[model samples]
Target: MLIAYARSLVYQEQAVRKALLELQNPRRKRAFGGTLTLGEFSLAPHLKTFFQGHPDVDFSLKIDNTKEVMSLLEEGILDFCLVEGLFPKEGYDVVLLKEVPFVLLVSPGHPLAKERKVSLEELFAYPLILREEGSGSRDIVEKALAERGYDIHGFQKIIEIGNISLMKRLTEEALGISFMYEDAARKELAENTLVQVAVKNLHLTREFNFVMMKNHLEKDEILGYAKEFQGFFAKEAGRF
Candidate 1:
């Protein structure tokens, strides 16, 4: 099959490229992409240290939602991506970097903020602030709701936002409650500007993965880099 042949050729290219990197004959360029959450908390913090140790490696990074980043990987626009949402794994190599819990965010003054935990029906009575359709966090929320025999439409009001910071700001202003990873709103939570609403019987977590096309030429090299990023994330989480 032509597809099989192409994959073999790509593997061969990876071998050749690794050899070239070892020789230091020329500067090697690496391309990486990630979803918004990992881009901000994971990749951004590790870059300076990574570059300091591997000066010969020239790299570029792209940040977008999980769907867009995965599309870019399939199209060869990115060598790999750090993803924070649900994706098909059929033809891709994946490294699970981390698993983070999802929580409901609300303003400190919101009525539900004082409650220890709320039932699904009760939580849906308030307005919901959510990331746009293609975002990883949004997809997770949708899936979680479905699993509980509910749908996003159950919310009294829905506010779709593309930016995480804006979503947090809106939540802080009591505009709506948001569902997202806890780390994304840590600073605000620590300051008591926002509070986490516990949903009774709900425990949801999302995975962060380093994903690449199965036959990408830099697969192994990128795997090493991915582990480095994972290490940094682990260290950060330990601090909390």
Candidate 2:
């Protein structure tokens, strides 16, 4: 793709400049972006430990929807991106980091809260609080529903939101049921502010990937962060 080729060229040029800068200063600077879910559950927590180990490294993080973050990557505003939604792999090198469950979330007071599992037909009775278009989680949900011959239109009502934390707060207020990666609501789930509503016959899982432009001069350097994040994620998983 022309876009990919252009991005590759830009990265190569920037790499040369970065190399020159490094010669004058031993400190390194990098920027990373990730989808909201990964930012909340993984990146934010891992960065604390990462900073402790590499005090001289100046790493910055940007959190946004998959589409926006990918745009940042293409513009060279980010060194790499971590995402949980589907993306074009043609021009990018990727690492599959982890697979996490995708689940429906409801407030404890919602009518469906007591159900162990419900059919798709039952869920259509309640309002759906969903991410706005161009979001990775929204795309995943749409694709999964299409496979079952349904769409968001099937819901009684639709509430479009762009913020993950606000979405969870609204869900907690019993405004509507929402769908997201399980880990995104881990804290709320632990506090019983939210509950998972399983859908019968609908099992969904998504992969977290470290994606970067192909032929990156610092591919290994970026991967060092990815590897460290994975280690922290695995250690945290053991406790949960």
Candidate 3:
């Protein structure tokens, strides 16, 4: 089917455009500027490197829930999105950046912090603080709960938080408990401000993805760069 599409006369003009974009003479300038958007917090260090490595690129990153990032991608408002968990492959190019575990977060003062193990149902008994509606963390946790015949909304007490920094602060204050990617709370865990308590009945892991609309990579040179970026991340996936 791809071959048939490639052979179609309808794409002849687009192919010519791609060829022109790949021509050496077209790249007269050495600098470019663009925006970077992401859903996962773990990408912070790598994102810093990505920007630092390309000083002339002048890129800025926006952090939000995966759903909103994908929305911006669909609207052509983002160059690409670094996402967490499953994303549709249709009409887009996807690169799996990494896979990491998500764990329960509790303030040092919370009862569960001292407990050896807590079940999913027992977690629902506490004041649960969750990421906003479109967040990847919220999505992953809800799906996991659904598989066990539970739901985030079914929890006894709930608090919805939009910002991760604020959520961590709230948790540190013993306002509520949350589940997040383990690396996201590493500093707090190390400082003893937050603790990781195993959810005895559940263990959740999610994937990080780099996604861009296929049309956005229309130029052969652009596609080459995107693939190169994919290889770079894949090589360092385990470290992230």
TM-score of 1: 0.88
Give every collision pair in model 2.
none
What tens-digit string does per-residue lDDT give for candidate 1 at 9-69? 6545665665676577577777779898778865677778877878888778899998888
Model 3: C-alpha RMSD to truth?
Answer: 5.6
Residue 112 lDDT in candidate 1: 92
Candidate with top lDDT is: 2
- Where does model 3 exceed 4 Å of error? 1-40, 218-240
Per-residue alpha-carbon lDDT of model 2 for 175-226, expressed as tens digits? 9999999888989999999999899999999899998877766888888877
Candidate 1 vs candidate 3, lDDT winner: 1
Q: Which portions of model 2 miss their true places by more than 4 Å? A: 1-3, 17-26
Model 2: per-residue Cα lDDT at residue 57? 81
TM-score of each: 0.88, 0.92, 0.76
- Estimate candidate 1's RMSD in Å: 3.6
Error of 3 at 45 (Å): 1.9
| lDDT (Cα) of model 3 | 0.66
lDDT score, candidate 2, position 99: 84
Clashing pairs in 3: none
